[model samples]
Target: MKRILKRRVLIPVFIIVFGLIQFKTIDKVNMVVPAEFGILTIETPPKEVGELISAACFDCHSNTTKYPWYSNIAPVSWWMKKHVEKGREKLNFSKWSDYSEEKRDSLRLKSAELIEKKWMPIISYKIIHPEAQLDEDQRELLISWMKK
Candidate 1:
């Protein structure tokens, strides 16, 4: 009797886990920055700085997010959505041209300050995206670009 009970519980648990794993959802990957949205018509910040920012920050802060395959899973996907929404609220690089001159200046200053304090990338992000890790020189380059 005890063996039968254990089998019943294990079978259902395994099925549930398997079912959860099979469930999938589509990620929102259509992130087109408007033509009039950026300060640079030809892509700003030079190649290196632009690459760094895109890798480290654009996932949440810009319209063009490159979603990974795992982003379609539960719990993780929910968290990703929330983080992206919050990041956009704080500063949406894809909407930069919509900001007033004063607001843009303030955001640029804040971006520099955040980079100097090692606070912009958010530690959780760098853990998974090792390429997003900015060395001291990269950080300096970003700061210089932001200030300009």
Candidate 2:
């Protein structure tokens, strides 16, 4: 009887907290991406490579994020917003023109290394977005293009 009473009280409290958090929505103001400043504009890759990068990296690494439906939820949206912010801070493909030639080259080398090690398009992202899941051939193509 005590366990049943405890669950009944705890469940309502959990629901109330979840609902209250919904008021604090994530800021989506930085979503607009100008095409002229993007990496594709400066150093255009092969079609397949471009497509692969878009699928696997753009959502977090670029300003033009295509937020999924679940992003409307509070804690999840908060986590995603922070993740994307960190990704952009590391390398914003949307602001690719701002980086120096040396920086760009270094970033490319790092990208290739990460992909080769299967450390990119992280597992959480891959689970939610199957398109980010690269097969051997696709991974090889991206790695080659990044090196080039």
Candidate 3:
């Protein structure tokens, strides 16, 4: 009787708490990306290379993030927002044209090193986004472009 009573009380409490938390939501707005500021518009890489970057890098590193369905949830939304903010702070590809030539060169070299070591498109991201999972050939192509 005591165990039955505990489950009855706990389940309702848990559901109520979960429902209440949903009130806190992350902003899902994707600001319009101007052609002048976009990396693809400025750099003009080959189609394959551009596609790879879009799949693996753009969501977090660019201003226009394509938020996933889970991002609508409370705790997950909060975490994803923080992750994207951190990524953009490191490098905002949407502001590529704003960077100086020297800075761009330095960023390219660093990007190559990070990709070569499989440190980018982080494991957690790749797990959910299979399209962002770059095979060896795809990784090589991206790394070569960044090295250039």
Candidate 4:
């Protein structure tokens, strides 16, 4: 009887707490995405190359973030927003033109090295976004392009 009473009290309290928390939310800020930025701003690679880069890199590296449905939830949205903010801080690809030639070149080289070593597009990101996985061909292409 005591355990049952405790469960009854806790469940409703948990639900009420969760329901109240739902009031806070995040919005999609698609308007801020740069219309004409990304890897293309650096050079016009082949269609496949550009596609591969955009699929894997744009979400975090650029201002153009195509958020998934879960991004609307408060805590999850907050978590994702934190990631996006952190990613942009490390490298905002949308503003690629703003980078000096040397800085851009160094960054490109670093990106390629990470992909070649399978360190980038980190595992956590790949788990949620399967499309971002780089096949052997894509990996080789990026590595070769960076070497150039």
Which is the winner by lDDT between candidate 2 and candidate 4? 2
lDDT of 1 by residue, 1-148 (tens): 8888779997889878867865654457656777468544434668788778788888888887777776877657777877888898889888887888889889888999998898888888888889888899999999989888
**How far is 109's C-alpha from truth in model 4 (Å)?**
1.7
For candidate 3, list the clashing residue pairs, or say none.
Answer: none
- Name the runs in model 1 displaced over 4 angstroms: 1-31, 39-43
Give the root-mean-square deviation of each candidate in angstroms.
Answer: 3.3, 1.2, 1.6, 2.2
lDDT winner between 3 and 4, please give it.
Answer: 3
Tens digit of per-residue lDDT, candidate 3, span 26-83 = 8878777796897899999999999999999999999879998999988899999998
lDDT of each: 0.80, 0.90, 0.91, 0.80
Q: What C-alpha root-mean-square deviation, in Å, does candidate 1 show against the real structure?
A: 3.3
TM-score ranking from best candidate downward:
2, 3, 4, 1
lDDT score of model 3? Answer: 0.91
What's the TM-score of every candidate structure?
A: 0.79, 0.94, 0.92, 0.84
lDDT of 1 at 12: 87
TM-score of 2: 0.94
